[model samples]
Target: MSRTEQELRQLYASTRGMPTGAAKFAVLEEVIRHADALGLVEFAFDVRMSATSVFQHSWAPEKAFLTFSWCLAAYDREPHRFGSGHEHTLLWQFKWMAYSVYQYPEIPLQRGTDLLEDMERRYRRGGHSMHAVLQNRGEAAQFTGEVERAQAYYEEMALTRRDALSDCAGCVPSSQVQTLVALGRDEEAIRIGESAVRSGCTEQPQLIYSELLLPFVRSGLGERAVEAHRAAYRRIRDNPHHLGELALNLLFCVHSGNLVRGLDLIERHLSWLDRPRTPLTEMEFAAAAVAVLSRSQEQNGGDGGAVLRFPTVEGKRRPDTPAAELAVELRERALGIAERFDARNGNTYQSTRIRDWMDTGAIGEPLPLSVFERAANSRGGERLQRLLDQVADRTAAGDLVAAARTRAAAAELMLADEQYAEAAEAAEEAIRELDRLGLTADAAACRWVLARAYRMDGPGGSGVRALRELLDSDPWGREPQDGGPGVSPEAPQRLQPLPLLPARPELEAALGQWLGYGPEAAGWSLAAARGFAAAGREEEALAALGEALARHPDADAEPTDGVLADLLGETGAVLGRLFGEAGAPGRVGERGPTGPTGLTGLAGPADRAVSPTVVVLIAYAEHLQAIGRLEEAAERLRTACALLDAHPDTEAAGRRSTVLTDLGEVLLRLGDVAAAEEFARAALALLEPDDAWEEIVLLGKVLRARGADEELAKLLTEHGLELEDLDD
Candidate 1:
């Protein structure tokens, strides 16, 4: 080994069992510097891996940022030397870069963009790159507010995983979940997340938990949120040293109304705060602590003037301290940390979060006014009422957009306090301002609040009538008027339809009117179809699907185009499901055997792109399976598997696995038990442990049917499945 490599190995061995802290990180910094002096390009990966441990344990965003920068610098010096095996390392660095940017919101956008450009450049070199590069790129785009670009990247990543059938398939799905959530596709995000979990992709429990919690809570799926929290706690229970994860869990607990448990978590993890932390962690910790403290004070029947006590450095709690005194103390501490971070690192995303936290005395941006509103609504008393009044005062001085938003927020507070008339009036005022400002989306949101307030007031069809009127007012769902204030001419066109309100019946009714009209006609149709399916109106759903299919008949034509890929995949999947449900006994796109059209028409193109070809083949195979053409279905799956295997650039390992799973099922139906077992086992090997459950169940059934009880038992044991559960 080279001297740098030898030193790295030595350090790794020395720190094998040691807990991460400032001392270990200090040594790592020196080692990285020494490696840089020696021009050890490969050693960059080693340095970064060690730094990642420190970042994870210490919650230090600076450590993550520095590590990624160093690694990227090494790659820049000698990009040619680093290839396939090293791509994962580069991907890891870039992922952390995005994470650091998110955690430290003051980080320069240019820095993140530069890193993303580098990754893109590397991937463009026509060599093997890790699947995670796409995910990292998406994350970077998301951090930079390039939502459309981010969505495209995330969709491509998902498509790549579906096509590739690679190991560790959970990563893409997990990323897609978050991206979908950010795009306001909360229900879809939750659906994707739940599917991944069911498929056994629970490796990153903390991520899964955090990502799923928000959407579930927003959608009022309390039981689901509790389930996610429990899973998160179970995963991190033995590894409580990760302060960031602990802080995130604490925040989730507080948000979910488990204040006592939140306090217990804080007390248990208090020692972690004493360790080295980046400004990001400090901000998160401070926010979580203050929220818990505030909740505790409310629970104790303490008014706004009541003093709040905190655990001392030694973790001893004092009962009587003024809340304002505590808030000021915490704010000062956060400011001091942020200042130090800014002085050392020249400002970062964390600084922005810290500033927001300090200014609002809250946990999150867009501010957690919901907490205060909840307190007041629940009769927690005068202090929260005063806070609401202050918000009203700010609204009076703010500009149009800000003033409108403040009113909507005030409306929420009023509604929570059961002041329905005030809520309605506030919402109406906000709606008028937003409408005049040409903020259609914002106006729609305000109308939703107003409608809710009307509903809560009882009797009369006022709420429904109000919603119907709002929908009618914008029948075509037009975009905000051009040249309107705050409407940028350069903004990307809307990627998806404006999300419908949570009121399913209203949304369904509005969607019914929008059929085959407007720019988002197909999207609206799909939403309606989903709503119908969820409501068990299968025939209505099928009819809606037919309308959507007619409107977007060319969805499968350009699968390589990032914008169209997700649409095509989703449409194809929906079509396949509907066809299966209909029990149709015809080939896909046959049209009475008058040659192919729609998705099937693209299947045999000699020059078809690999992604589109795979998607079309899958849809065709699904149709064949639904029509009892087992042999044909297997053939298509095998072809897809061969194509995926032959093209590594497509990174279709995940897709390959899907084919394998399907082929196994088809072969089993054909009574070819041995081949089915082989294919199923291969698919299971390519999938993560969590994702292998279904395959195990499949193979276990095959083994049992053939009276191969011993082998079935062995398979269950190897995959951590219990025979008893299988029996159940």
Candidate 2:
């Protein structure tokens, strides 16, 4: 092989381990340039082909056109030199090129239409099915406001059999679903989407979930819509490539009375609008953000402003801007982009769609997205009546298991309503019926309700004992094993862990609060986290902690004299024993005399514990990092660090470094190399000449970012670590 070829191979190999994003794309572009300069025709074609995919996944898919055009021209001049494989790849890329053509007004409508016809002719000549060609035609027609034509093409595409050239199973249906929804055929869209989700696809559920959000809401299936939003948002929240898809979810939040949540989504992803992958996607996202921000502005009497954090140099923060101002700005940008598309298409279609979406009003009523929120926000009498109706219907049908399950559900609602006595009674009846029917899972759920009721109703420690007994008995007949928490073999997969999910987390948090500072409290909190993790409900878990924080003493206030002093003393004694680095080293609550509110002992010089708020905030940061919400996670970690900075406590002081290290890692993920380096250095400065692996690893990221290989090697040698040790 030639030296140039070997060099190209080495460059490609080095990039294999790099992540997919701007950096990788830039490197791939460089490789293409090198191949072109070295007079490697086929090699340059190969590199450009890879560059096209990288472009498609990056924030500028339209940028692929230049490289793709070169490849197309090369193939047309000498098809035999590249082989059938290259021809097929070239034809497939033609589909993307055709779609991209409509994204800009600079490319005329005739250009897109001609490209579609050319794609069809080539597919026929290559002996390929018209499936992919028809699909692209339909999408192009849809973009150009030819809904009827789009529908006809979609119908024809559906009838056509799949071939190696057709889009993936999930993708075609997702596109069709979008077209159907636009054509006022929501039910049909939902039908297609439901089936597609059931059968699965390469991007199953995730891609289709966003497409189905509007359909489900339009069909008055609000609960299902909420579930789709949660699932879709979780899947796409971390992916910068899914900005357009995430926009749909933001609109759902607006229509469903989740104004705060809509704002949260906006805050998390608004930076994506800075450089949207395509103008079409940018218009969609801006339209959605306008809708959300406008509604939020009205709700706040046009006074509340949202503080959005954009990616900035040196961890600099963006200024707080009013919702109305941001809304107007986004609205103009969206309308302008829409006008460009419409002008290009010689119609008002794109602009009208953008205006309609921006001005869209909420549906009849707000939909609560979580089980607990639904139960809590629902009207007490109406919700109870519905649960009772279910029980009556199940009983009349002679479905005893169903009736018992309904009763358990009703009991949960009753607890939320504070009807503790009636809830406890209902729970007992359900538990007996389920146990008799040999439904261990159902029975276990009822027992949890009963335990909760026992706690809320009266007898102190009754709820605690009952929960302990239930856990000890191993109601699932197994420990949490393989994959996640195990359930009884007979238990339904959907109902694993418990009946009311979010309710279980709430119960765990309550149990932790009731126990106060001890091993039991920490255990309960951990259990709550595990349950939430198993359910893929990170937001709800953090929310549960937030609720717990509210219930605890005024953590924001300093511990002075009087009641505050005594409270702190009591809290400090128990927390020091339970959580401090150097304590009695026995069971929590083993030291000190019993005092006010069941707290143990008085605070002394030896009892300086970290603030509970700081601890929980740090934990929230960690969980947020795990779920890919880097910016928000960094915010929470900074909050924790600030709290530590204010107090300067001796207990768990290493946590300050841990928080800084975490913030630095999150900055690294966000591509703020300078900010990441600063935080890493701060964390390292806080350390007292210790070789803490996490801090060292964070510093290593800083060195590597600067291409300081010599410095990194020396640091590693000094710390007795290796490059591999710092990976991941």
Maximum-TM-score candidate? 2
User: Candidate 2 lDDT (Cα, whole model)?
Assistant: 0.69
Candidate 1 per-residue lDDT, tens place, 122-179, comes to: 5556453545667777766654456678889877766663223123545566767767
Off by over 4 Å in 2: 1-4, 304-316, 370-728
Tens digit of per-residue lDDT, candidate 2, span 1-728: 23477778777766665556667778787787788778889888888888887787667787699889899999899989788888878888888898788877678888788888889899999889999999998989888999889989999998998898888877888878888989889988988878777555646677799999888887899879987876665456555678888889988988788776677567647877767878888899999999998888777777755544332312334565677888888999999999888878888999999998898768859986533334444455876767766666777899886676677777777887887766765676566556556666666667777787877764345576556556655545543322223122332221212343224555676677767753346556555644553564544443444433333334222433243333234333333433342332232223343333332232221223335445555654454455465676676666556556656754354777887888899888888889888888888887775756788888887888779999999998988887887777
lDDT per model vs. reference: 0.57, 0.69
Number of clashing residue pairs, candidate 2:
1
Q: Please give the distance, in angstroms, between residue 700's alpha carbon in candidate 2 and its true position after superposition.
A: 40
